[model samples]
Target: MQYLHALETAIIYIEAHLDEDIGLEDVARETGYSYYHMTRLFKSAVGETVGSYINKRRLSNAAKELLYTENRIIDIAIYNGYESSEAFSRAFKDIYRISPLEYRKNKHDFFIGSKKGLNIDMLKHITNSITLEPTIANFKETKIVGIRGEVALKGNGLSCLWEQFHRIYAAIPHTVPNRRDFCVCETNQTTYKKNGDAIYSEMIGTEVDSFEEMPDFVVNKTVKPGKYAVFTHMGSLANLEKTYDYIWGTWSLSTKEELDNREDFELYTEQFYSMDNPDNRIKIYIPVC
Candidate 1:
């Protein structure tokens, strides 16, 4: 899709100019999109606004520099787009729950225990098994009725949310065909924690034609229409993290496409036999520009 291709171009442009002063107009111009159109398309596809993504990426890169280099805090801050050490410290503390100096001092211990340091052999094995290529798909606007919650990206928050949703899914009326279930991940504000955990709104639901006359207890959400990069995840649910690690850590970084700031979801189709079955398969749809 042209939109997806353009988005990828914008991401590449942003990444290359992270140390420079870049803005929406610059990115939109590079991708041949109007600022308004690009903003809408980007927010609908990537889940974070363009400005947010840039800021986060800059801060993330700054954090890495703090850990890996001997540069002073002010220099690191200025280099990453901040004008002053105090301003950078505030932003850094917001996401990482630590000042830049504190982060640098404890970086090794914190990162070593997190998902960022996945075992090389395990990552290779997971990447080897899954096809990293994604199919472009267009979806119409969809209305889903189900349970929603603020979930932590790490630990059992997602699993617990699904378990809760399953307990009441049967009572929700008027589900769509093929028993398709969706696990939509979205962001309300800040994306991640200092420890590398992200907080997002997770909705577990089935597609519905409309939201009218829904029960008071049911939460209704609309999935905006757009082009998506749909990748299939294979193997049991227990090992699903490995698949995601490869997608975000490996494939996304290598591809020309940039992740859209829209809702990314997991679609459970008929092929998803059971959580324990090694043959279980599910489709993961990521909005891309």
Candidate 2:
């Protein structure tokens, strides 16, 4: 578990410093793991070399800037840590199959995939099967007390954090009623890096009336009152990523609603029997304006 936590911390460090000149040694030192051990763990867990991940993320962000911003290609390249425009263009064309200028001219389709391109057909199928109509609910400000950590948005860090939280939840004091667990993703500040990799502060805890008497190890947080687009995720927790992909990639993009800078969270109700259960249902709430 400690190794897993260290790996996640390394991922966050990499994401937070992608625009800077970073390397494996920097990540290893940040996470307090040896260079060889960190490399092996990252490869095993993330299924990609650290250098490859960084390159792909840089290219992905550069593509986004090309489509969204009017910055010159050379400037965008430099901003993304490329030494030269020629090198940046070469890498961009390698992934996008088009020159930066050409992509900007015909910026109709946005590529949001990894080195392995996204399967649009599969995404459509998943979106079609799930009903994502959100219910508008006004929630009062709520307090949560639990252990918190930084997790990489792309890898298994979030899931692993949840597992660790569950293991130690019994030790925490002042938990609330109905066995309702809150998996909160803090997005109000510095949630994502330029490379589209996120360093989210996640907490797995229960609601509390106040934080006055919280234990020393537990962290206290507040969820502000707002209108939320509440969507239900009915399936195993493992497949929750598919639902998220659809929501962020397809639905949110198309919707007219503007998302607010608040913490999005998962409400694990009584129906959530266990992580592996097929029938476990969780409610996802996204703060929206």
Candidate 3:
């Protein structure tokens, strides 16, 4: 709780001075954590660098100003700690997919990329139960057969998918002795964009020795053999996305390893306790070249 309290302090400090020129160094100093410790802990727990969280908060605040006030865009930019309007526009367009003028002009279909500030409750849920660091593994090719469906980017879409899979689980034929299950994220890359703006396809399946006599509704997927960075998540399944945010947001970008672009999956073994149990263990495998 010592470090988590420090993280909470950092978030409060950032929120208190979103309009000020708050640097990572300043936040780290305020938290009384060393610069290295601050960055690493922030990355693991918040799923982003301190710099990133600050900028997003600034932009999120600036967005509200644009909508609610008649302030000049450049003035709003400076108020948000951006040096110039051009730099702010570039940063804003990267996440919101449009210029400030476009965002302000259209009252429809715009979004704030990072809306909420970090809180201690969220940090504890993300950090206390999981080993955020990952181990690299050379995984073997495997096959699975299960139900697949379109799931929304938010909410309990996954629970419904898993329910359908479990109902048909006993009917599957030629299963391997390993009872481990795979919750594979089969995102359709063509329509996919960052920040939950595309159709999400997911599959829940178990390893199978053969695909013979499989039900027509169920399709088979092949997980190609390759190197992967395996991360272990423990605790309630509700906190699972926090772990993914850390992987995709901070770790994947900061690591020296190259992403292999293969299908990544959640591996559920016998060690998995009930979904609500804090002892639940689920392994996440991300392909790396």
Candidate 4:
């Protein structure tokens, strides 16, 4: 979540300058991370780089405005910071899979979705080379008590959700260590909004010993055990997403194993605590064949 904070900060900045000519270097400097680092972090965490995400979002907004408002197509394009309607239309078509003129004539009848955009829950499997190091192992399902929040794939929204969780969990005395804390993210991309954000659950077990006090937490899920491709995230929250891209986009493509459709999760390598340096460490456990 801490690495997410830095990204959230960057997104907020991008939104403010949607109409201006913004550069990656400028944004990276503002966020105190290098361009390469920021790009990798964005890819790993959100599955899209900052520039691509912004372009798609801007074009989406422009398209919406074009249909809803009577503004000239060129005006709408320029307003959203595109230099030429031609340029805007090309980009818009690439994302929406339709031209702007057709879209406008339909009068907001349809919406454009991003092609380069990614699903937030899909785990990326990265390794130095294509090696099946016998990392697969069995895991029993876990039942945890925790609070939940809805989040977008990209936005300042998730950061706020974490803050809210901190507030709610702080009031509950049951969140202390030895009880163990669990953050569960429920993924349903069908309902995932334009922002690519979805609902996530933050849980602190009230009944670590048993399910006597299920409390307000949902007890409906039984996480299945299977072989998993594991990757270690070393140091700092910012680079986590890059690691994901390496695994999912690169390593998975090269390896013989195919990803198994199951709930992926972060395995706390050490005593994982957000209170500790968020960038410190964690393991992404992706179910695979």
Question: What are the models' TM-scores?
Answer: 0.61, 0.58, 0.76, 0.45
Name the top TM-score candidate.
3
Name the lDDT value of residue 280 in candidate 4: 51
Kindly provide the TM-score of model 4 when superposed on the true structure, using C-alpha atoms.
0.45
lDDT of 4 by residue, 122-199 (tens): 222222212223366666666544455554444445446555655555434333355544444454322433333333
lDDT of 3 at 198: 44
Model 1: how far residue 58 lies from native, Å: 14
- Name the candidate, 1 or 4, with the larger TM-score value: 1
RMSD of each: 12.4, 15.0, 4.9, 10.6
Per-residue lDDT of 1-289 in model 2, one digit per residue for the tens?
4665676677677778879999888888998889898889766544455676677767767777886789999999999999999999888776666788998897633323333222433333253334556788998888877778887767778778887777777766666677767888765443545455667678888777667766677787787889988888776776776767656644454356877867788988889887777677788888898
Q: What does the lDDT come to for candidate 3?
A: 0.79
Candidate lDDT values, in order: 0.74, 0.71, 0.79, 0.57
Flag regions of model 4 displaced more than 4 Å: 1-134, 167-180, 189-207, 217-221, 273-279
- Model 1: lowest-lDDT 10 consecutive positions: 109-118
Q: Which order, best to worst by TM-score?
A: 3, 1, 2, 4
Per-candidate clashes, comma-separated: 14, 0, 0, 16
Q: By TM-score, how accurate is candidate 3? A: 0.76
| Candidate 2 global TM-score | 0.58
Residue 222, candidate 1: Cα error in Å is 1.1
Question: Compared with the true structure, what per-residue lDDT tens digits does model 1 show for residues 49-115?
Answer: 6776677678767877786679999999999999999999998776666788898887532321122
